[model samples]
Target: MTRGLSRRALLGGTVGGLALTTALTGPAATTATAATAATAATKTAGAGSRRGAVGPEPYVPVAVGAGGGPAGTDRVHVLKIGPDTAHTVLVLVPGMFGAAGDFRLLARDLVAAVPGVQVWAFDRREENLADRTGFATPDPAGYYLDGHYRSQDPTAAAYTAGWGLARTLDDLDTVVRMAACGGRRRVVLGGHSWGATTAMTYAAWDFDGRPGYRDLAALVVVDGGVRGAFKGTGQPVSDSPEQVRERLAAIDGGAVFDMTLSGVGLGSRAESTQIWYQLAGWYAHHDPAGRSVLQPRLPDALRPSSPLTNAGLLGTLVDVGFGWPNDISVHSGHLADADADGVRGWVDTGITPMSRVAAAYAGGPQPAVWEWYWPSRLSVDLDVADPYVDTDLARSLGLRLWHAEALDTPLYAFQTSYAKGTIVSGARDVVTNSRIPYGTYETDNGMTHLDPLFADTPHNTLTRTLAPFLTALR
Candidate 1:
């Protein structure tokens, strides 16, 4: 039976976890960071893991560190692959707490179906959860958890254990250079969710002269939002941290919805899973209503999906660090302002922060299935209190910001008709914000956060689709 795709929401705001790392030596480190991640059993947890969903014989690849850099620059791992020949080399980047395996279909499809292209999904920087355990110290780097940002100056050093954006981009630069087949085979640089944000950031960084960050046929962004300065409003906020909390208390029916990496101190990976579990539960419950409209673009197969193993999840969230303005639930004002020309937008949405109590009832399944393999107590910092309040790291990451950068929408408008670049977006995605024609600056074929991956779902379609796009690049 051809099972229909499930209706899983994107990461559903559940941040696996993250912090910061310093081992970003060079392009080799970038290459090494994501190169040797342990590849899991494909059939166990892959793109087709959704219930009743059946199709390809679960594509997997065994990727070992073939050769690159000096003798022992980094280690190598393997991936599971079915039967196919790859002509194009794909460097798949995952968002916070994400792994190389995350890009199952994109990699599989492009490698298998997309003729003459070898797509290799990568496990980007600082995802290693080997060192620290049981809390971070209360230092400047420790207490500076801002809003959950996929692509921004990473401030969650103490919050989790992820790599810095600059390092990740740099690592990617070298990985592509080292593992790349050179001009013989074209390369496609792509990121999923925060991974896409990293892609855009890396693109900008490359344009800014980041070493090893170069030469790509095209960029593929799977269901990601643009972050920067706001466009319309330029006013500063009036509320303090306390004021922000109070604002949430006064929300209609005492409800607060937040999907930030903020406030997650030292707890079990359960808390990490709890975050998304609850959020996904919320989305699944609220899907009938128009409130959770942002997630409709997810592949139908993913909607009914179960929680993924929390193995390297924390490593993912720590990279971005926890902290955010209350914008996910309420109409946010963060990205409300943008010049589009200069990459600034308006922050009009008015989101609210969450209370300790609210998150409990709202969270979804806190799976303990992989406790044996992934471990339970990933990290903890009960000692590190907020500068203002003596709460946990969650509260520490939770600081209400007054100003944020809006994105420059039309900035990329010049890419099209000139460079073979076409924009991919879901109409329902709030990241598109209030475009005049509503997401038509480039090739806004109505894509959302999850649209970047789900080829066919609602207003979520990618004109540049992965396979052919990377194939043509060569």
Candidate 2:
């Protein structure tokens, strides 16, 4: 797996910059070509034409979830871009509250980078849109309930990791079939946060009826969306939001602490809001546009929550084992470098976890499935030997419900010292200390939670330091 922004101006410089922008409004041949190329590029590249910075709009939703029978809570919207009949398809899974819109810049770059290829993004069914629309939830427990077949409740009943894992793999399998119907042969499964886990899980784990698990060309796990910390390795724990919170019980940290407290494993919607607000504010200092990117996703109900407060965000992160406390400062461990100052501040904050990440990186032939965002509870455990449901389907479905250790096998554990290839990345600002899951024991300092999605970011350094590693896929 290969893991993987901008700045503002001086107050006085903005006026001059605006005047320059206004004066250059002439549509000459160069501008015309740029526009033409951009348009052609979008059609060739699969850029969504959505408003704002997220490139062109998304492809007409061809089918909801692969074979088209909706598999998720959110209809899996799939869009295919490109005319190449026999091409490699990149299946993208977005993070929580993330939509196809999140891949704007990355899709454009990928289209331009890899010729004869298509990129597809899906909206998984995990979230309940009804809360926003004032409609009642279709399934009150929403698929992750304790007694449900997908639930990771062994003591409560029995384990079902397999159920949850199967759900994700099957979703991808459906998408793969739908995309394959159009004739794409090779597939690159890519995901961020929870999406990444789905992508990787599908990669390594075999789908019940799906054929050609061997046909997978690559896997991109962004941050440990699964069973462990940011790196993703370590025994999986079914730590509740409060339990995780308690682990990092200490506060009194600075900006880093504040960042973690504001954004990590907050159980309720209220906690997430507070952390996001702080992030929106902190990120605002660098970009003139501020964190408007958050406005679209951050619920209006959370407008009152203050995210900048240090304790809540950082404290929450520590407890969840996501954003780590600085080994040196022991205060906080999250930062962004979309802008010059942000980058500088990040560089100065403390030792980059990547730089000091000590791990043994050797592994074996590896499981085909690669789970990026590991589940916290045993939701549906496939690997476990339990009596919840005798059939395999029941356990497979459970993998989706809880965070389990087995899910992060290939990516986090050193069980694959002999394997020739692996795909992994973690975001720097991940609320989940997800990096561990990315490497069996080896750490890619270049990776951060979002690095795989943001080409310019540090996490997906493979795109930068080892372009051939990816481009060769062509």
lDDT of each: 0.29, 0.33
Give lDDT tens digits, candidate 1, residues 1-474. 000011121132232211111111112212211211212112222323352132343223222232232233233222323322444566656544445544443444444455565555554323232111211222211221221312211122222221233334455665566445565555556665445545544443432433222455555555332331111112122225474445344332222112222233321222243233233323322221112221232234222121111212211221122221111222111211112221111111111111111111122111100011111111111011101122343234331111111222221121111111222322123234422122223343222222233222212234333334444445
Compared with the true structure, the alpha-carbon lDDT of candidate 1 equals 0.29
lDDT of 2 by residue, 242-321 (tens): 54333223211111011212222222322232223223322222221222333234334222132211221221221112
Q: How accurate is candidate 2 locally (lDDT)?
A: 0.33
Which candidate has the highest lDDT of all?
Answer: 2
Instruction: Name the runs in model 2 displaced over 4 angstroms.
Output: 1-55, 59-74, 79-86, 95-102, 127-163, 204-208, 212-215, 224-267, 270-443, 455-460, 465-467
Error of 2 at 55 (Å): 6.9
Off by over 4 Å in 1: 1-85, 130-162, 206-213, 225-271, 274-448, 451-460
